[model samples]
Every structure is written in C-alpha cells, then in structure tokens.
Target: MNSIGRAPNDQTADGGLLGLSQRLPPSNAAAEQALLGALLANNKAYERVAEFLIPEHFIDPIHGRIFQAIVRRIEAGQLADAITLRGEFEHSGLLDEVGGTAYLAQLLTAMVGIINAGEYGRAIHDAWIRRQLIDVGETVVNNAFGRDPELDGTKQIEAAEETLFKLATEKGQDGGFVTFERALTDAISVAEKAFHRTGAVSGLTTGLRDLDKKTGGLHPSDLLILAGRPAMGKTALATKIAFGAARSLLVQGRETGTMPRGSVAFFSLEMSAEQLATRLLSEESRVSGERIRRGEIGQKEFDRFVQVSRELQALPLHIDDTPAISLSAMRTRCRRLARTKGLSLVVVDYLQLMRPAVGTKPDNRVLEISMITQGLKAIAKELDVPVLALSQLSRQVESREDKRPQLSDLRESGSIEQDADAVMFVYRDEYYLQQRMPKDTMFDSADKFHVAMEAWQHKMELAHNKAELLLEKQRHGPTGKIDLFFEGEFTRFADLDTVHGV
Candidate 1:
C-alpha cells in the first residue's frame, strides 16, 4: 500500500496539521493584511482566499461550508453548533453534500479564531462578507439590467437611448455632444420600455384596470408571487396571464413583426405540462374537457382534443414537469435557456412543492424558504425576465372569514414576502360564497345547489369559462384585482370584458 501513493504522512510535511498552522492567513497581522487586500481588490475572491489562506484547516469543502455558514450566522446575530447545523442541513436536504458534521466544527473553530484574533479579524471578515454579497448583488443587478452595466437606472436608460438615436439620426454629423450619462439613461429607458411591452397583451388583458393603467406591464426581473388558499384560482389567474401573453401574439399582432427570441419556461412542480396543455386545449375547443381527464371522452370529444393539440403545438411555450427542484439547478437551467434561446419569462407553478438540494439540512423551514426565494430573485435578475411563482396561503387564512390572502398568508415562510419584488394573491368571492346563500335574497339552504345547477346550465351555456384574477400586490404599482372568463373545457382564460366583465 505504501508503494503507490505518498504515504498519508507524505501529504503533511511538518508534523501533520500542526506543521501547517504558521502558514495560515494573518497568523496574526500578516493574515489580516492579506485578507483585507483580497476583499478590497475583488469582493468575490474571498471564498478562494478563505481556502487559500488556510488550506490546512479548510481543506475540506464541508469545512468551508461550515466556516462560511457560521461566520454568516454570527454576523446575523445567531449562535451555531453541530446540533443546529446538523438539523439545518438535514432539513434543507444538504447533509451528504455537507460531507460530515465535524467539518463544520473545524470551520467554526477557524472562524472564531480568525474573528476573535482582534478587531482587525472581525473587520476583515466583514469586508470579505461584504465583498461576497456585493458580488452576489452585482450578479443580480447585471441580470436585472440584461447584460448592460450601463443600464443602471432611468437616467442611464435615457443616456443610452440618446446615444443610439444620435448614431441613427445624426449619422456622420457630429450632433453636438450627448453626454455618456445622458445617453446611458436614455438607452436604459428604452430597454425597460421594450421589456414592459412583452408582458402587455394588446388583444385582451386581465390585469387590474387601475393597476394596468399605472404599470403598463408587470416589468421584467419582477419576482411576482401569486398566493392563495387552496382552490382560490391562483393557478387559474396565472394561467390567464400566461395565456393572455401567449395569445396576444397569436390572435393579436404583437409577435407578428419580429421572430420570437425565447417564449416561456413554465416549471410545474405540481401540474404536468401536458395537463396544462389539455386545459388550454379544452378552453380553445369549447367542449367539456373534464371528460377527457376522466378518460370518458367519446369520438366527438377525441376529435376536439386533436384540434386543440394541433393549435397548441405551435405556441412558443416550454414546460418542465420536474418535482422537488433545487434553486441552483433551476438557475443553471434558466441561464442556459437565456444564453441559447433568449428566455423571456419564467413561471413556477407554485413554490412550496419544490425542495432544496440534498446534502445540506436547513436550520429551519424559514431559512430554507429564504434561500429559495433569494435564489429565485437571483434567477429573475440573471435571466432579465419576469419570474411568476405561484404560492399557497397558510391554514390561518381559512380561519378568517375573509379567506383572501395578505402578505402574512404566504405559506411556509414570511421570507417569501420579503424577497419577492411583487406579491399578488388571487381570490374569487363567488367561489367562496358557493357555501353561503345571498343575504339580500330569499334563497336559502339549497342556494349553492341551485347556483351549481345554474352555473352548469345557464352560465355554462354562455360562458362557464369565467374567472377572477385578484391582483393583491404590485410592489411598484397599484394593488387591486380583475375578472376574467375561465373556460373549463379549454383550460383557457379570456378577458371577461370580451363577454361579461366589461
């Protein structure tokens, strides 16, 4: 055994790890100086420097995780230990990837040693962590700006636009001077306006009348969370937006001029893409679609399915029916899509069903959710596209007479409300009232039964296909709601204004 590789002792030169301590960063002041330099020069390079500065101890990846996690936790005003970390990693499904528990202990030992070395140690840690976050934030901001660092804000947008306009309109003429700042602001504004136009359906729109008037579109890089209690039409309303956006190009003239760059990536942790497609098909076919779900469709129904399938095959929508996805995996996939296909929009059919990757147990459900939402915000920024994630309300919502969800109702964790750029909830008063009779009317007890019958016969005749999209939140715009037509047969949502709401 000693013949092949260097003996285990060969890897350690000066008496195992004890020989290596002197080489550790700042072993005193020197280590602090080196770390400060790394943090100042490159914010993201700390992880590398962390390993480089103390390879003897952080040689293992788990140790790095532990070291980073503990330092971050300490910074956040929390205590850390194997018990807490083990629970966190297990809950977050990260234990195996975390390697072993002892590594975390070693990592913490290193953090405490480094952090307590003096105020300088703490300062270095803070600078390093600041750099890490700024690195992350830069990635986020760049994504939000869509590959244009110059697109910093409205001012940058205007500046860039002016530059382009000058180049086009001025041609060879030296059109005075369009300051770089002014041109950059103009360009950014142009990029923003272009992004906004994608979400605006020219034909039939369902966003709140008031809100729509203010925002024009949901805006790109917006992490929109649509949450509600079970059966609250969360999916129904989101689908309305999806269908509305897609059809705007189909029935209307929006997508006619330019070839599509990327359509939509609708990630369904709960529903299958085929199932969503079937719903849409039924809505378009104007035939009872539930029969197909039950596999009781006769020849005529099968014919309708065929027609619907033919129509949907051409839409620029892609669906992934993956269950229990990791945030990192989603980011990788979305980034690839954006790079290759120019992804336009990302939709997650509900968030709670997703799971963190295995190997690391999260300390608490709240932290796990925080990580997920934060990851999603990153993805939204990176892809420079809107991320529409569906969510569920807590059981507390059911306890209240008003089942309509507020930010507090975001199930699993409040971190969702904090992380999302925009939060929306879908509610249907009519759906809620099916259990209670109208107070003004004389109808009693059997009112729901009668209403169900009427919905099936009378309304179903004209439009059993009706739904309401309650826009409960819009971070930068108005908060209200809207109504739409829900076609059960086609699983398609239409502007109720086309039939009734107007």
Candidate 2:
C-alpha cells in the first residue's frame, strides 16, 4: 500500500481480509497477490469463486460513488470532470471523510475512469459462472454432463459456457462476441432467435400483429417515439400500448416463479392516471369516450364499468400524472417504483411537454427538445426498460402532397430521430377529407341540413373504425405501415382485419 494508504490489519495471517485490500492497492507484486488472496478468501459477493478482480475497480466507498457518478455522466454523454464529481458528492452529502472537498478532488483525479459496458458485461458473466461451477460441485472441464455419448454435445456446450465465464473473470476478455462481415448476418441471427425461442422471452408483446411481427417486441433499453399532431391520436395510441404492455406483463410474466407480474409505471406529463384509467375502461367496456367524460352512464352501464374495472384492477398498471415533469424527477420516481413494485415499462405522454433541468433551460426550442430526447434515451438504458414517449409532428406534414409523415416531420426531428430506436407516426386521412361526398348516389346521406329536416334527430353513427400505423423508422427490424381498427365511441384500437364498418 502507499504511504498515505490506510494501515493493513493483522488478520491476514489467520485467513481473514486485511481491510486495506478493499480500499488501497498493494505497493508491490507480493502485496498484490496477498490482497487478491484476502478478497478471494473472505468476500461474499462471489459464492464459489476464490477471487474476482477487475483492472479498474473502486479503491474505497468514496471512490466507488465517484466512479458511479462518472459512469452516469458518461452514459448521459456529459463530460465528467473533477468539479462535476465533487459537486455530485457534495450534493449527496457523501463526501464527509478523507479531509473534505480538496481531498475529494484529489481522490477523484486519481481514481476515475470509464468502464465499457460490454467488456464489464463479460467479466460479470464470468465471475457468476465460476461461482456457480464451484458451488454446484461441478468439475471444470473434467466431467461430462452425462455418461451417454449423446450428452457429449451438452457437456461441450457447458464447457464452452464455462470457458466464456472464465474469460470474463479475467480483467480482459479477448474479443468474445461475434462480429459479422455482412449486414445480413444480423438479420439472420434475429430471424433464428425470433423463430426459435432464446430460453425465455422478456417484455410485453403488444397485440398489434404487424408491430409484433416486425419489431418482435418493444425491447428493453429502447426509446420508441409515437408522434402525431393533436387529434391525430398520439396520446390514444400511447395509452393503448401502455395498457396492453402492462396488462400483458401482469398476465404472463414469470409464471410459476417469484415475480409473476411485472408492474408498469406510466409517467403522464399531461393527463392524470385516473383519466387514463377511465379511457382504458371506456375502451374495454364499449362505452362512449364522450359519455364517460360526461358521466352520463345509467345503472346498467355503470355496472358494466364496475365489472370491467375489476378485470383491469389487479393488472399491475401504475400511473404518475405529474404535469411538466423534469427528466431527473421522472427518473427518481421510476426508480422508486421499480424498487417497490417491479416496474417493467415506462410511458411519457408527449415529449414536448417535458421541462429541462432546473437551471439549464436552452435558449432555443430545438436545443430544448434535443436535451429532453437525450435524457429520455439515457433513462431508458439506465433503467433497462422500454420507454414509450408520445411526440407531435410538424405542420409541414399537412402542407405536403403526401399526408403521411416523413422523418423530417418529427418536431425537433434530428435528436428525436437519433435517440429513438423506433419512430411510429399516426395519421388519419378522413380527418382531413377534402369535402368530398361518398359514392352513394353522388349525394351525402348525412349532413347538417339533412339532420335538421329529419323529425327524429337522435342520429349517431360510427364511421370506419380504422387508422394506419406507419412505422417511419425501426432500428432493429423492417420499417413499413400497418392499419389498425379504431373505435370512435369506445376509444379502442384493434386489428384492422376484424374491423366492422358502420
């Protein structure tokens, strides 16, 4: 250890850890081996492994927090300098020891570096597997999985797994993953994995057939943007997806295991959770969305509402309807929900509505939008879950000859386009129908004048319950369009093939 390092304990002679090993690096080769032995002998983080060592690790708890802060800043694409690290510790009230602020800077300057996620991923896997092999009483490469020669393949596979794990335990893994020469190799592997189950599938599968077919599912660590202008059904689509994912996860998550249902956290920057729930209820119960808003339900309708509400009740769907939520505040809430209720999916209703950090608002709208989108992306990766955010399209879409949205139609399109793993646009042509009459005897059957002339005026009819789901960009799969049935009264989006016209 260094002259400034904490003194080592005398327990090393009795097969116990010298506390210095956890915080201070040994001064020489002999001391390094002894420190490694101390960690290997007494550490409980690894079950069966003698020791786990990384080339870059925390010297102490203070250093660990500083490292974590740097990692977070790096992931967010912000520079993590000494000043930033000190400020973080000071804010958290974590840097009271090691002679206060000046020492904090010194420690950080000495002990901060980046950790490659993929590289560390391999190391973690190795440490875990080595522990498993030793504790499970399995000989490393010495025994077969079974006596039968047919089991030889299984044993070989296990050996391969163990070998990979061993590589991870080392400070470095020598390029363990496959890098394909052709782009089609990526496609082929995805196809293979999709058709043949990769152990178990994670995440909720939205009932949208084409969406599920193309994207497989809304994957973890993804930022999926659903963009459309007002009255273009952006919020409705977002709410629909959130409802489906949360319900599905609650229905089929880890069946016969500890976590049978993974609850969803819906961070609504616009509507209240109750409002969202009512929308879901109206959709599920076939009640008119307007009627639900008007509270015009009869006893029978109320009964049906009560019944369907019960069905949706146990499905672990949580909603936090905080208007104008800051990104960090949203993150804190989501993490809390994840800790307490096992959160699986997050939904931010309309990204444009979000506020930037307290003191760091940009001067221009484009810059502000960019900051919000990037923050959402970071939150998605950090939480290891899918973040579905609703956005607004630019006015140019309506002005163009083609009403369908292009990449440029995305409001603050660049950053939103870059950060998003998938960008879906919702469009309704009938909403902008150019005063053309239907082809029924060249006369409009329904009109304001016609309604006035009729003696009975209780006329209400649903038009085509359909909308097109245009996949503008899909990072992992094919980008195309799919149509879905939209019930105006019920506020439900269903498969277009099953649509019934009125």
Candidate 3:
C-alpha cells in the first residue's frame, strides 16, 4: 500500500494516484528534495532562493520542514548541514516523523550539485503556483455552486479576481535590488530623453505647459491626487490630463509609424461615458456641453463637433464608466487593457466614489478610503504606470475665509496624502467669486451698493476664466500654485497666459 493506503498499482510512477481522474495537485517532490539536499550539502546554496522561496513552496512535508530549519540556521549566521538539521529535528522530537537521520542522509545523497539549487528552488516555486491556481479554481467553482449565497455572480467574479491578484503579488518574483551603476544609467537615459524632448519634460505630459514644467510631467509608478470641491473642475482637469497623455501617445505612434505601445485608461465612476465624451467634445470643439445636449448648436458647430470626434477616435484612450467600481475589478481591467493595448496611464474620476475590494469590509469610511488609496498606489507600482485619481475635498475648505484648498482639506487626508506621490487641489476663484456677488439689499445707500458692486465686478474680472492648481504636496519637486485658464462654458483647463496677460 502507498501513502493513501491503496494498492501499489493505484499509484503512478510520479507519485500521483491513478484511476481517480488521473489528476493530483501539481507538485515537485523531487525538486523539493533536491533543493533541500543542495542546501544541506552547501549552506551557501540557501542564498540563491532565499528572497522568493519559502518552506510553503515545497511539496513534501518533511522536505519543507528540513528546508525551513536550514533557512533559520543560515539566517541566524549559523552553519546548516544534514548533521545540524538532524540534531534540530531530533531536539524538537520530530526526527522519526521526518524519516529520521537516515532520511537526512538520503537527502544529502540526492543533491545533484550546489550550482543547480536555484533551478531546483524555482521548480518547486512554480509547482506551488500551479497548486495555488488549482485551489483558486476550486474556490471559484464552489462559490458558483452556491457555497456562499451572499456572493452573487458579480461579487464572485470580483472575489476571484482579488484572490488571483493576491496570489500573483505574494508569489511573483519580480522584485529585486538594482545596482547603483545600473540605476545611474537609467537616470542618465531619462535625462537624455528630457534634454532632447520638446519642453524638456521627462515624463508623460499633463497637457498644461506650466504643470509639465513644474512636475517634469507625470512620472511612471506615481499616484497623483487631484482634489477639489464640487463644481471646481476636478473631473475636467483630470480629463484634460488623460487627453493630453493619449495625444502624446498618438503623436509618438505617428512618429514611429506604428500603433502606440500603450494607451490611457480612464475609469469614470461619477459620469457616464457619453457625458464624459460630450465634455471632451466641448473642450476641443469649443461648444458648450449644455448647448450640445440641448441641440442648441448651429450646423457649423455640429460639423466641428463631428470632426473633433473623428480625430479623437484615433486617440489611444479607453474609458470605463462602471459606477462605484471595486478596486480589484479596476485592477483586473487595467491588467487586461495592458495586455491587449498596453496601458500607459490610469485615471480614476474620483477615489471617494470607489469601493474597496469586493470581499473586504472596512470598519469605517476612513479605513475604506485608506485601503482604496493604498491599492491604487500598489497598482501604479505593479503596473509601472502613473495613476491620476480625482478626489473630493472636505466641506471644511468652503467654511474657511480663503476658499483655496489645502492638504488638510483632502477627504480622509491621512492615507490619501501618504499614498500619493503628489497631491494637487483644483480651485477656481471665479466659481467662488460668482457666489459672493454684491447684493443691493445688503447695502444701505445706492452709492455704497454701486461702489461695492464695482469692487466685486473688478474682482470678478481678475478671476474670470481663471483657476488655481495648488500643489499641496509633491514628493519629488517644489510645491506651489499653478495658474490655469478655466472656461466654464467649455469646461476646459489650459495653461494661463501670464505673459500675454489674458
């Protein structure tokens, strides 16, 4: 009888059960044994896979225990060999359970060579990944079979995605240290690109010249927060940046005579795709969105809008207007887009409207926001792309005398500020000024009302079509306010023409 108490004929040569669908969880007992043997033979071999391989990656329970003992001894700066491991196991009263000292001697004999330890470790890790995939598949099947009634179809999908993401993150061996010389070479390459590139921007351009100048453009693996009060053009600013990135990709593709290697993904949770498209049309065609919706445009304006839409159709931009999208689903979609179209940038309409991963239920809204922000930052780093997330400020900003937003005004400021590489506030003085227009009833005399009205009108003129982008926090650069031109009718944001005195 074999380990399962079945007839020897029921077992396959590779240790898998036969006549039971001929299937067994993926594993590599031989590889696990060889790796453990290599470590026991030469303690130095432990360093080869120390970064990624763990005891849990081994298939054989005894092999995993032996490997873990070796790891502990080696990490503690103590010599680890077959003799030392046997002593440790014996001391713990598990020597017989692990096949005794005879098994330790057998493992040492199994070692092919110390040089092959890394390969053996990788084989064991790969088998472990396959095993985890099987488990995930089983879970998904069980959930579908009504194992969890609370998980509807959509929730189940999200849960599956989250599980896969977690598995990939935990088991993937993509992170390691880079030599300083290599890092310096990359730095110089970036500098060279910036030196030759127009505007000397080293990263993806934000479409606004001043913003690009201040930030050197949006960088890869960066999480930038664009926050503002309601009607402060947060979405409009984020859309402008997305459009700019898409246009840059298109221009680069044209220069190379090939499709852009990557595209922009905009997740608009607050607005429908059509509404966002209309706003883009308004910005480019200089037609009011309200007028476009109401069919108030002339034939010429309609023709302009159609032409703009045709041009924009070729831009490498994708929009998903999934209302209140879960973070896991968003990550899954981004990964899919990256695989198919090559994702360069991700823009979320607003983080506050997003829900955390499907299965997680945070105790409070603050924790929920923290999870979302951290997840976004993780996505940016994992995908090596910039994530521009729009955010809403707390009402405290409105209650202040100076309505300009600050870092403290960020809703759930702690996590948002900590996770973000940059935090910017979109403040339109015109919007606030419009709300405080002088009223005749507030003044006692006509002259006083007229004087006040004149002053208010003057302030309005100064702030008309103007906006301020306050860079409250920047991890890599200076923090200051950037002036922008905001046309409410078109819902557009552009570089303020300070020299031209617009």
RMSD (Cα, Å) for all candidates, in order, is 19.6, 18.5, 6.6
Quote the positional error of residue 172 for candidate 3 in Å: 5.1
> Cα miss at 127, model 3 (Å)?
11
For residues 1-502, write the lDDT of model 2, one tens digit per residue: 4434545444455677554324433222222222322222222212222223332333344433544555566546565655565577678787674245676444433321222222332344444444444433344333464544443554455444444433433433333554554457865765576666432233356756656766787787899998886777777777788777876676565465455446777777788888888888988888876887788989899899999999887777888888998776676677667656776788888788898754476988899898889988887876678899898888877687768788888745548998899999887665554233334354456574454434222221222455788898988779988878777677678767744432
List the candidates ranked by TM-score, beginning with the highest: 3, 2, 1
Model 1, range 1-502, lDDT digits (tens) per residue?
3323343234454555322222222223334433333333333434443322331223234444544554554445555456666787888888778765664444333342332333434444444444434444455556466776544565343334333333333332442676788889976775566566545422123333433554465556778887877776667567656765554434433346664545677788888877777766766666666777788877887887797788777665677888887765566567656655566678888778877643347898878777778778876765567888988777897789867677767646848887887777666555555554334244556866677566545533443345555665667657666656554345455556654343
Please give the TM-score that candidate 1 achieves against the real structure.
Answer: 0.54
Residues 1-502, candidate 3: write the lDDT tens digits: 4445555357667875564323566687888888888888889998799888988787787788888788889978998987887788889999998999888899888899999999998899999998888788778888999998989998888678766765766584445797788799999998998999999999998889999999999898999999989999999999999999999999999999999989999999999999999999999999999999999999999999999999999999999999999998898898778767998999999898999987899999999999999999999998889999998888888789998888877645549998999999988888888889989999899999999999999999999999999998999999999999999899999988999988
List candidate 2 segments past 4 Å from native. Answer: 1-47, 50-203, 411-414, 434-463, 498-502
Name the candidate that leads on TM-score. Answer: 3
Winner by lDDT between candidate 2 and candidate 1: 2
Pairs that collide, model 2: 1-27, 465-486
Count of clashing residue pairs in every prediction: 50, 2, 0
Residue 275 in model 1: shift from native, Å?
1.6
- Number of the candidate with higher lDDT, 1 or 3: 3
Worst 10 residues of 2 by lDDT: 41-50
